[model samples]
Target: LTFNIGERPTFRRFSTPLNQKNLTPFSRHRDDTLNDEIQSIRSLLDRASSGGDRDRASALDRAEKKLRAAQGTRKSYKMETRLVPDPRQKQMFENKLKRLSEQLSQCANDMKALRGNQQRGELFVGARGDQTNVRGEMSGDEAGNMMINEMNDIQDKTKSSIMNTKNMVSASKQVGEATMEELLRQREQIRNIDDEVMRVDDNLNRADKLIQKLWQADGHGQVHTVLRVRQHAAARGRHHLHRDDEE
Candidate 1:
């Protein structure tokens, strides 16, 4: 119906399958990268639990070591030893407690010593332009003053450390006392539990005897129907006798 003039400047056509084919390898490569990333994430998740456990274990170990050092004991006592009810073990614990007291006393002495010799030659320094201090012989005094300053610094640090140690010792003693109290409470609880078990067993045994007696009465149901009937009959006979006596 129209003359075939010229081709249009632009044309629309459906995308060829070859274009999609070109993207297949790239898509596969991207999927592999994503898969690798997912695997890394999964690996971290798998290891997270064990790593958390290891971290917890390390922290507990460090705390144990520090507490032991505070108590002046290099020996690592097992957690079970605290539960063993041995008289000799009790004596050992007492001895260790005594040692903590002794160590505290030693720290006190160190503190005293540091305080007594605090800044012996503080603020004493060199003088210049003098006969005895000619050619600056008193220059040596500057270094001496520095040495004194350093000593004072060291003494101050030692005092602080001693106080900290004393505080730690006190805290350790408190912890020990608390631990002993808890142990005593646990022992009491265990005894109470044993008593409760015995009582339950006794009650169970009584219940068993009751059940056996009931079974002797009836096989289907553990009820003493025959004995109950006998009792009821005896009561009725007693009532009839009372009526006859009244008549």
Candidate 2:
């Protein structure tokens, strides 16, 4: 007796294929359905993991391990698609990589040049003449002397620069102080002018009151007329006198 491992028949109607070639569509559809199911399972697993469910996390970890194994197998598939040898394509890729490498090297060199530009100081030597040196004939003594000269030059330049900067700062501070003093003086002058104006206004008011009193004393008669005429004459005289002085 032989036992058969077979799928149970369902009540749903199904189409029977006439030929092997025609069966490809059905096979493809089945494969697509299986892929969709796998994707749904993975999505559910992801949600469960993110929700912090401990049981789901353990299940997800185990599922992920299996998936990672599958991904490793898929990596070979990717390599077969991308890295399998086609000489022309391979050469093109290599040339592209070479150009990128050259660009990277040039970028590195440019960075190095920029760094060199920013670096200060020079090599020199000191007076002590030691015989043993790295560059054979150019002994430690010569190197020390060169270094000493360089250091002296740098120090002299630095000192001069510092002095110049100090002078500039001092001059600026003096100018600022002078400007502030002048502004204070102008403010005082303005205050004095305001006081003078207030005094002049007070004097004018007093003069107006005195004139009104004098008019009242005159008693609306010939005395008032005489006083007005005299005032007009005096004003005219003052104007003419000022004109003569200008000439």
Index of the highest-TM-score prediction:
2
lDDT of 2 by residue, 12-50 (tens): 433643343433343334334434434544554555434
The Cα local distance difference test for each model comes to: 0.48, 0.50
Pairs of residues clashing in candidate 2 = 124-146, 124-147, 125-143, 125-144, 125-145, 125-146, 125-147, 125-148, 126-144, 126-145
The prediction achieving the highest lDDT against the true structure is 2
Candidate 1 per-residue C-alpha lDDT over 1-247 given as tens digits, one digit per residue, 9 for 90 to 100:
2334595455556665334443434433433443343334334333422333333334334433433343333122222224335567545654544554454345435434432332222223222223243221223355466677778888999999999999999999999999999999888866766665566566556656666777776684535554465456556655654554454
RMSD of each: 39.0, 23.5
Question: How does model 2 fare in lDDT?
Answer: 0.50
* Runs in model 2 lying further than 4 Å from the true structure: 1-137, 220-247
Q: Estimate the TM-score for candidate 2.
A: 0.35
Candidate 2 worst ten-residue window by lDDT: 117-126
- Model 1's lDDT to the true fold? 0.48
